[model samples]
Target: LDRNATMKTRLTTLTWRGSASVDPRFSAAMLPWSIADIRNHESYVTLSVGVEDGVLAAYNTDFELQFEHKLRYILGYCRVIVKQEKGKKNADFLMPKATSTRPQPITIGNDNVAEIFGPEFGLVYLLKNPHDPLLHIHFYECEKYEQVGWVSFLIKAMELGKCKPSRH
Candidate 1:
């Protein structure tokens, strides 16, 4: 194989094995996962419509989708927020424990919230400046996960601050 092809194969090999590192110990309660997929050259990932904390993040970027799997869980959690309040209207997510406008050197504040929409998780952590506001609602041309019994768990998290699915 050519050098580029070899590198691509190696990268895929590494990327495909990423699920091995998922730690069930550390608290992934707050942020589900970082849908940062850098190896996808064919199919694209996407996020549904929703607001995170207070920031208005709604866009599509390739790598963002990789993180979508994680973010989607969070958003799915939000849906739980809505359901738990069934006889209610608005749902408020606890502010983030930290934030940053410059990516690195993340500061501390609830003003920072991230979101993924459209074909991927377009991260927008700052709420004051208002970066992007177009959550391309139709990024995934195909359905990824069936948004069924998944939402209830999120509601359970809102009430408890962490997702604790009742083990049967």
Candidate 2:
């Protein structure tokens, strides 16, 4: 359970609308550590994403949109999952088999969209193996599996515990 896997990794922050900003409300919310502390070696991450109504876009580090296009259907929901590199020698990361079967979808709507163009949710990732730090966020078309946009993140171990550890 204490094994360390070696691989070349690059972690970057997703820049949205010229800055890496999270919904203040989402950031201010609390995490339920009591529920999380039950499992040994378990950790979690809260992801905040912004979904736009038109022209799904991907941006480069310069704060410029790299890819933008209108999809056939409107984005309805998304899923966040913990992923790990396929092998020590492989650069590709894969979502675990167990997670593939029962991923909870994160949905944005009129009720939850707190502000115009500022819809957000606290997408939580309950990591299967606490040491492996990666996340895949995939958005899909309304009522369908048509992917609209996606982002991947490789969390640095040092940044994992920025929050004060639970006293439990």
Candidate 3:
């Protein structure tokens, strides 16, 4: 098999599991009541990379699909605004706590995708397409633990996605 075929196989089968937590600083600023909340409050999450409906996709827990973007090598440079999944609540709270301000969108490039995973308040990811100038994925997390493994998995996913066959 060619290299692209191998990469496509790996990307479609890649899966990683880990827990997410709120960053103490962000939590203190936004959800002061949760300051005492234990790290990794969400317990566990599973993320995967795959192709759906002919587009490269990222799947969150329970096989729920998130962002979909074209492969950079196939589509050339482009820009896509990563949006939150509909109906997905941020954190476990019934409603967002009252705050003077709302969360802001974070802009990231291919090189900075991993940084999003390390933030204290939000979960962010980079879409597989490197040519996208504004590609990013963002979500809320109170605290995160076992991030080293998560990062490793994500990096591998990104590498695999880069080499995925264009025909898919």
Best of the candidates, TM-score: 3
* Backbone clashes counted, model 3: 8
Q: For candidate 3, write residues 1-168 as lDDT tens digits.
A: 243432343333222322223332332123222321433344434455554224455566455655554544221111122223484423332222223466333223454432222223333233333443433322323233333334334444555665333454
lDDT of each: 0.25, 0.24, 0.35
**Which candidate tops lDDT?**
3
Q: Sorted by lDDT, highest first, which candidate order results?
A: 3, 1, 2
Which digits, one per residue and each the tens of the lDDT, describe model 2 over residues 1-168?
A: 211111112212332212111222322121222112222233222222222332234434443444443322221222222222463221222222323566222333323321111112112222222232332122211111111122211111112332221221
**Superior by lDDT: candidate 2 or candidate 3:** 3
| Residue 66 lDDT in candidate 2 | 49
lDDT comparing candidate 1 with the true structure: 0.25
Can you write out model 1's per-residue Cα lDDT over 1-168, one digit (the tens) per residue?
Answer: 233321111111001212112222322232223222221324433432222222122223332323322233322222111212455533332222334543322222222222222232122211111233322111222222223122222333333546332221
Pairs of residues at least 3 apart in sequence or in different chains that clash in candidate 2: none
Window of ten residues with lowest summed lDDT in model 2: 2-11
**Against the true structure, candidate 2 has what lDDT?**
0.24
Using lDDT as the yardstick, the better of models 1 and 3 is 3
Model 3 pairs whose backbones collide: 21-142, 21-143, 21-144, 22-141, 22-142, 22-143, 23-120, 23-142
Please say which candidate is ahead in TM-score: 2 or 3: 3
TM-score of 3: 0.26
